[model samples]
Target chain A: MGRLKSRQAGKKFLAVTGLFAMGVMLLLPIFVALPALAGGAPAAGGPPPDVVAAQEAEGVEGEEVKVEIGRDVYYKTEGPAVGAPAPKTADTEEFYPRYNFESRVLLWVANQQHLYYGSFVLAVPIFCMCIEFAGLVSKDKAMAKKYDQLAYDFVKISLTAYSLTAILGGILIFTFLTLYPAFFGYLSSIFRPVMHIYALMFVAESGTLYIYYYGWDKMKDGLLKWLHCSMSVVLNVIGTVLMFLANSWIGFMMSPAGVDEQGRYLGNIWHVIHTALWNPLNVHRILGNMAFGGGVVAAYAAYRFLSAKNDEERAHFDWMGYIAMSLGVAFLIPLPFAGYWLMREVYAYRQQMGITLMGGLLAWLFIIQATMIGILFLTTNYYLWQALGRMTGGERFQRYIKYFVFILVVGLLVFITPHTIVMTPAELKAMGGQQHPVLGNYGVMSAKNGGINAIIMTTIASFIWYQRGNRVPAVKWAKFGNIFLITFFVVAHLNNIWVACYGYFIPANVRIGLSVPQVAGTLSCLFFGSALNLAMLSKSRELGPIRWGQIAPRSQYALIMLATAFTWMMGLMGYIRSSVRLFWHVNEIMRDNSPWAYTHTIGFGANVISFNVLFFWITILFVFWLGALGAKKAPVPATQPVPGAAPQPATGH
Target chain B: MQTALYLIISIVISVAYFQFIDWALMDMQGLDYFYILR
Candidate 1:
């Protein structure tokens, strides 16, 4: 045990725990900060003349500490001796205890609403696509009708969830008004038209979701299906717009513009809308939310599937799980890039803030972020493996599992390692600087090579020959394709190794910048290979029929796990991004000081993240269950007695 | 011609925006000496 504690295992455990602690610490700060920053500041009833004069009198006549810059006194200059009290100007102490209570509630509501909307927008639509595709390709009419009914049922579930989303949004607005009335008033003044636009969009989205859901039965015919699906497209557009409109408020708060230094209102609202990091965040949030939503819905499907009565039910759920996992991972693939873009914007807006997020004092939060991401990838890979058994030719490919596991573990360890350590002076000396030279390289490109290489492999594995589920490749070019793939992976691995090793020697800014092309290269390999494989398999033969309805209950849980991981990771990363500014309320406008400034441990952060995720899923599940309970069960799909008679696996059902 | 025109426009706009931001930040930092970065 002692030896284990002293070895690499101990190091990894410590690193992982450190990652979680960082999340708690970083997230706690915002809960403490918003109230402090936005609260107080210019209370009613102007200061007594004597109070102002007492501030001016003390000792020196010319030493006026109150330096007014336009309408707002940005700061109070240093005055008198150390023992002398701070020269409290008009609303110097900025104390509004009454407002703070409500503001706190408002902030929590906003955060929750953000999460809810994030999950709702993504989960519902993806479920529709999944069940729709499922129904569309079913072999027998009864089976096809069942799929259609299930797809219809899925949209019905989303319709109810959408209502919940609206209710939550309403609560958020009410909380905002009750808590920070004046601040809300000021923000509202700036966002009057934007809010109107958002309201209109909400109406549009609600109409679209309602019409689409209610019209499902009426629109079951051929051309009607296309029209019905288009409503989904419309709903997504409106949802995206709603997110963007809401972002204007946060973007303005963080990167406030449209006003001069004095807080005077500027006429142009667009200046207020596109606050520095706003657009990137909009993109990031939309994608992240969808991925998160996908996770919740997937988890719901998993939970439901696990409790199914018969083999047919299990089979149906197994497919649902696979569909959910695919949708979640698809969105997830672009998340890191979106995050990178957001970080770049953060740096562009304020370099110090970016450093604080990635490499400075608040860097621990990002360590937590790395850990979450690692878990997300790990869960996704696990789900894929579990899903393999559900596919036809799945058994034969089991031998490749060990290789996938190896690459994944190596990648995760590398991804989560700290760039530099806060060690004792003695420890630092032994390691040569604050970073471990040898161990550090593992954290660099070699590890990324392991990670991305593993992911690419998994993506390749995901493209299982649906035709025979267990059928081996038989095309004449199959050998050549395999050779080409091996060569591609080898070159990709070496390319990462070359870059990562070379990165350490470069300047810090440039070194970090190199991640761009490195990521690009990995993605190129991933997408190109997947596309090529699909093309190759297009004309391939199938030896057996797919056994869709005969899946393991535990396999369904894998999809749920995969999706939940994405949601949790999104929230963790979002928190990290927001916290990078540290004590700054709005770049330079307000400073923050609260007890929640310290980083909480990884265990604590993960628990809370899990709590939020569980809360979302459980509520969503209840909604799904309730909807299913009230609605008439669609007709059961009747297929031929011999399942997998002819492989019908084409696209996701 | 269109590409050249767009390029010219973009370059001019970028340069102007960059300079404006630099000037604003410099002015704010120099005058009050608030630790905006921190």
Candidate 2:
């Protein structure tokens, strides 16, 4: 039909636009960087060569003259001052305006809220891209349609949050300008060049996201859907670029570069943007966002499941929750490694900062974070086990659940154990040391690493069992495959524990290296164990139908618990990272002379984090309500029972 | 015998893979993985 041809041409047009947009987003950074590179920033503590030549010629032709130059604090490069040093602010109304309330606390609330919404919006688009791609590649038409609907539902939830993110961003900027004008002004001046680029990228992201969402129905088939899917890739690239640009500002504040000791610019913007902690931060945030985003989506699915009017709705929501949680756990597994890298970079940049975060004042927050991490994994494993109840042959693995719990509980106890406790002089004398003798041994990083890795390995094994719950591998090599998996996991756990035990006997410097191997052991199980399990299940026999909507309500609550833990941990970590800066606005480069520069008590910090978590949840619940308001029927029909594909509504076994 | 052989071979392969990961990752960070031996 002519309509079909027109649709085909429209698909080509959208595809070209998507590719063109991606090219621009990719090239924008290169174009921005090349000019600055070509500008030829000076050597350390000296003027540029051209400037030196000009000055010499002038002196030879006339009277002697001197050209002033500044050395970069981080890069050690030097150039004539391109901008003024950071302003010396007094506690006057001009520098720090206020209305009988604490400015820092207000800004803290604003920034945390903005970051929460921003992370959610950015993470959802990437999820959409993944789900949409999966749908496009799916050979089964019905499965493909369901995937498309799931992706659509995800983007719809984010669309409302996206608008709120922008509004919060504006509010944050206003808060900065009003509360701490001097500090904001100085940062703005330093990051002036890239600020507009960041703004443009935001606008581009908004346009792409809108088109990708609104064009879904029109481009439901063939090449048009591919174009729509590829547009999401462009959208995510822009979103990530925006996040990096924003991270650069924070990176500059933490470990300043391209500026002198006096905080004067030395003409190289790249050094300022790409500070020592930048890449580590970028990696950490990306993984954190993905995990956090998955948690939120899973929670939404759980909410829908609880209130579902019928079995079909319950089944669809249950499957949705599972997929979201799996995606979350996948990212959550690698998150600790990213955190370690960030911590390592912090140590590399400034040892005092690292000490303050882990061993000094903010150390208690880390204890809290470790507790949350334990809770998250425990809840994830519990949910997976409960998920097995929906299958007929699931009872075979049910007896092993207690052992997984035992291992997990042991790991959790070791992980949450503290190295030392605050004690009065008399109490310290009575105890003879800050550390409790036997318990303290378990509190060290070595034991903690072993504990967490064991927990992660156990979670992975649980997932593999869940995946193969009702199916028996029919391949000739199935027996060997099963043995290999079992051996691999058992040995991996032993290796991890051995490494942890070894760390206690080794030098601290060398002991630090042990974590790398321990992490590898855990990751090896995740990749190899899971891959081989999938291979074994490729031509498996089904034992029975996997009853989809038959799961207990408690499993949905577990998803909610996982999401809440993720949100709380995010707030806690953000507080720790920001507070570690101590009294400085930009580390040592700029001082924060405000009355509230001192760190709050741990109790107060916890209260503030709790408040942020509560506020975020209350608002997000509203967003979910709004999403539910427009709902009519379930997105996917009740899946018919099909053998070998438990993922469909009906059958796994 | 085949089952035991399968387990042993898997254990060997897993151990070798882990050892390489440990050495390479630590070496990348400029740390010696066999610091105790050295």
Top lDDT model: 2
Find the candidate with the highest TM-score and give its number: 2
Give Cα distance to truth, residue A103, candidate 2, Å. 1.6
Which digits, one per residue and each the tens of the lDDT, describe model 1 over residues A1-653? 77976765655555456445545544664676566457543321223458657767853576757533222212222211111111112222232224433344346436765567556765567557655765665667766665676567567667777777777767777765654444566566657668877887777777777777777776665545655655566566566767888887877766766544544444445555768878998988777776776676677667767777777766666665555566666677777778777877887877777766666666666777777777777777666666566656677767877876776677667777777555788987887886675666545433453455445445544543332355455676665555555555555555555556556565555455455545655665556656656656665665455566566556666676666666666656655655554554444544433323345555665566666667776777778788757744654444623233332322321
**Interface RMSD score of each model:** 16.1, 1.4
Residue-wise lDDT of candidate 2 within A1-653, one digit each (tens)?
99999977977887678667767867876886575567664322334469778889999999868546899888787776766899987788998999899898899889999999999998999888988998899888777777788899999999999998999999999999999999999998888877878998888888988888898888787666777787888889889989999999999988988888989877767778899899999999998998899999999999999999988788888888887887777888888999999999999999999989998888888999999999999999999899999987899998889999999999999999888666689988887787767766758999999999999999989888888888889988998888888888888988888888888988899889888888878878887787888888889899987787789999999999999999999999999989999999998899998888999998998898889999999999998887887665444345642222555211110
Task: Tell me the alpha-carbon RMSD of every candidate.
Answer: 17.8, 4.1
- Docking category of candidate 2: medium
CA deviation > 4 Å runs, candidate 1: A1-106, A126-147, A422-468, A590-610, A631-653, B1-38
